[model samples]
Target: MRQHSTSTHLAQKSSWTHPIYTKKQILDVQTAHRKASSWQDRVALSTVKVLRWGMDFVTGYGTYSPISISVPKTRTMTEQKWLTRFIFLESVAGVPGMVAGMLRHLKSIRMMRRDHGWIETLLEEAYNERMHLLTFLKLAEPTWTMRCMVLGAQWVFFSGFSLAYLISPQICHRFVGYLEEEAVITYSKAIKDFDDGHLPLWEKLEAPEMAIKYWQMPENNRCMRSLLLYVRADEANHRDVNHTLGNLNQTDPNPFAAKPKIEIGLPQLQQNGRVKD
Candidate 1:
């Protein structure tokens, strides 16, 4: 077989393929979202922040910190190679780093005085993230089934919330910001590199919506050419909620506005990788 190039592979697309966006495309979207902000728009944001940070910290949940992760583990093989890849890369690098911090946050919930409602609400969501992570593990390890853990990451998006809750919800959004914006590179590479051009039946369901919604919009903005455009959008929304809440404390809101543009390059596949826009 001829050696296929990464650029050639990414550029090659079928008729049904989705549009891809670049860093500039995302900045354009930011320009649009920037104008839509208002004081009244901040109400829900302030409530979420205050509840997440203030009352929840002081009265509701308890004092919380961040989560942490464990060391990488030795792996056993399975019929599905991709699952092993997911486990090795995502579970090891992706989760442990983010989740360790979230664990600390969970432990912090113990410091709270209780008396506040929404503990169940919080737990339910937390449970959802756990479930998603479990599914992620399944996807990564493929000890049982087949699926791209990239899709799993999308479905397991609640990991963002877990991150948020792990830290003071106020500042937690800062971490959420990382997941939303920075994480795309991880998932994007997963999609780009893992596409061996074959997927099993059950794997189809894992991250169907993400594959469709993120990539298949009418705006001609997706092509899987760049993952940061859409993934960063996800981070922006999480931060928007938090930034708006900053208004209550008279702190400067609108974080991404000033956030120095993080450059989006090509997939860092290996020592052989080259930067692409």
Candidate 2:
């Protein structure tokens, strides 16, 4: 039996069974995918920001300060800066779903009524966000200070979202929807920066092993930009789902069914991944 050379294997792997794209193509698609296309879309996005601002005001001193200090300017968010942002961002991101799920579970038990599948879905969302945190853990080790910040941020956000969820789940869900919208924008910028020659570090970086496993990304096609795209798509799905829930009446059919699927095409590159747009 003839042994194949490494280049032979790699060439075979890189053969385009699917459409391959350049960095520009992926970035263009992501921007287009997340763009708010119409007047109503624009208004709704503005409203989300305003509502989130109000919510942030309630705990702004605590939550906003850490974010402001941690996340660098978009052009400056190199791998380390972005990973630091993810450490804190993901810690807080995992909170709302767990709090909402736990509260819904108790509400259902006390009322002796089924929870309309909310408990399971919310718990799943929580777990997914936790997975995001875990994936980032493989990419960056937080300093002791960053670890303390994560602990502090999680405690405050958990308390705030829990109370808000208990008082008015609509606001709680809307808050998360808005948060996810911001996440979508953040990831898109990261991808753009990397593609545009700003994040030189990305050229030398491989996608985290956990990210590849979680997204079922091709092993031969793994890069930091691909991971960002996948994670952004996840956030976009969460954004749409929570927004739909916020707009619904309690009797709405199949809330879980309303969530949008991710839909971003992955490049057939040496290190790229696919995301459901």
Give the winner by lDDT.
Answer: 2
Model 2 agreement with the true structure over 252-277: per-residue lDDT tens digits: 33345323311111122112321122
TM-score of each: 0.29, 0.68
lDDT of 1 at 274: 18
Tens digits of per-residue lDDT for model 1 on 214-251? 24443343333233235444334433433332232212
Top-scoring candidate (TM-score): 2
Name the runs in model 2 displaced over 4 angstroms.
1-75, 257-277
Give residue 221's lDDT in candidate 2 (0 to 100): 59
- RMSDs, each prediction? 18.1, 12.0
- Per-candidate clashes, comma-separated: 15, 8
